[model samples]
Target: MDKLLITRGVQRSPFWKFILWILPWAMLLAWGLYGAYLCLAEGLNQTNMDNRFAFGLWIYLDLTVIAFGAGAFFTGFLLYILKRHELKSVINSAVVLGLICYSGAIVVLMVDVGQPLRAWFTFWHPNVHSMLTEVTFCLTLYLTVLILEYAPIVMKNRQIRKVPSYLVFEFNLHKLMVVFAGVGAFLSFFHQGSLGGLYGVLRGRPFAFREDLGIWPSTFFLFVLSAMAAGPSFVLLTTWLVEKLSKKRLVKRETMSYLGKLSGVMLIIYILFKSVDTLIWINSTSPSSGFPAFEYYDRAAFGTWVLFAEVVLFGLLPALVLLRKKLRERMVWLIPSAVFVLAGVALNRFVLTIQTLALPTLVFDEFLSYMPSWQEVATFSMVIAYGVLLYSLSFRYLHLFPQERELTQPY
Candidate 1:
């Protein structure tokens, strides 16, 4: 079965070894499913959320993965639109990663919504004034685009492509890929910005509220830039990890360096704008609302260090490292820089989702903190396990890396 399913000329681990490798992830997935089941069967009571702290770990996960998943649309934009042909080496992998991340985010959101059965209300009764409505529409539409983009890859499998109909279908799908890529990028741009705008429009939460840049707040554009910056780095990191685990050269050194360079250039742009946004908020936005911006960081846990880490340490440091040609070429430096960029994105999401909810908004309100229940942690772990399992299966069966055969074989 493995032999028939595996792509021709691509080396995969023995069937038994492969089974052993996936066993843990499979178990983790099952455990996570059980946790999700409990949440659905029981209710919102299963988690530690309440009226004041409606957003929790699950919301954070949704935002973070969606940001990381930006690789799919951004990579497609680079390859199909910009004519950066070198990106072909990792485009399929990017699509798969995008599918996993976006789908996982939707699943988590379903659970977080509490009334999963009534989730369609967003579409049935739309709210034209809400950023969430835009986010909902764009996320669903972009996910559909990712699925369509991924179809050709799935159809190109060893046994699947043998069928004449499937072969023709894949060939035709290949022709329409650029259109899907364009649509996906368009959808992703709106949703990513809307997610940030969701926080920025929270007038009740001065820590999150920002002055409108025209109609949208500063966070709106900032989120888009951050996602674009983080996307390629995530793709590069995942590709490197796959290479290490499989003990194979999946892509060329130049491809990896190119991804790093792209990420660095975007990161620098994002950081510059982000710094300006922060300064504006501190000097004008928060103060105008009668809340001192620095006072928001007076809490011991949510201190000034978090801002420093997000902006300077994770943000500026990684951008500098990846922009340097010599440093990005080295695996040690490149990998850590990618990690930092991702961390910066995650930290930004955390501050927006968790810290915003945790802080006191009213004059007499006390500082509050909330932690995830076991159910939340398990459900979160489920998404990671799901991504690993899916990527492993895709790598074993699909031609994710175009350069693999040439890099490994003697011509």
Candidate 2:
């Protein structure tokens, strides 16, 4: 059965080894499901979130994963629209990662909403004024586009491709992929911006509030830039990890270097914009709102160092490393640079979601702190287990890396 499903000419681990490898992740997924059930069945009370900290660990996870998932649309945009042929090597893997990240985020969101049954109310009773409404619509549409993009990959599986009708479907789907890529990019741009806009519009939380740039806030564009920068790095990191785990040269060194360079360039642009935004917020935005920017950092657990880490240690440092031909060419420096890029993005999201909520808004109010309950931690853990399991299955069955055979086999 395994042999029938596996792609021909590619060697996979023995069935027993595969099962052993997946066993722990499967158990973790089960535990996570149980935790999710507790959240949905009992109430959001099962988690540590409250009125002050309504958006907690779950929201942070959603933002981080969505940013990491940006690789799918950005890579597609490069390959199909700009005609960067080098990106074609990793495009399929990007699509799968996008699907997993997005679909998982949506699942976590449903549980977080605390009323899964009433989730349709957002679409049914629309709120044109809300950034969240825009996010909801774009996220759904983008997920659909990702599914369509991923379909061709699934249909290419060994036994699946053997069917005449499936082959025809895959062929037709390939032709329309560029269109989907365009739509996916459009949707991703808006939703990614809207997520940031959601926080930026918070007048009550002066720490998060940013001045409007035309109609949208500064964070809107900032989020889009940061996600674009982090996306390629995430893809590069995952590809390297897969290569190491499989002990196969899945893609050429040139492809990896290209990805690193792209990420580095975008990171530099993002850092520039972010630095400008920070200066503006500190000098003008926060001051105008009657809140000193330094005060926000003066609180417990969050300090000026967090900002420095996000901008300099993680942002500028990694961007420099990735941009350097000598550094990015070496695996030792390249992998850590990618990791730092991701960490910077995660820290940005953490500051937005956690630190924003922790700081007091009113003069009378003191600083507040909140932590995730076991249920929240488990539910989030579920997403990681799900991604690993799904990727493992896809790699075992599908031709995820197009260059694998050519790179490994004799000429």
lDDT tens digits by residue: candidate 1, 164-202: 899899999888888998999899999999999999999
Query: Which residue pairs collide, candidate 2?
Result: none
What TM-score number comes out for model 2? Answer: 0.99
Tens digits of per-residue lDDT, candidate 2, 203-303, equal 98898999899999989999999999989999999999999998999999989999999999999999999999999999999999898789888865898
Clash count (model 2, backbone only): 0
RMSD of each: 0.9, 0.9
What is the overall TM-score of model 1 with all chains considered together? Answer: 0.99
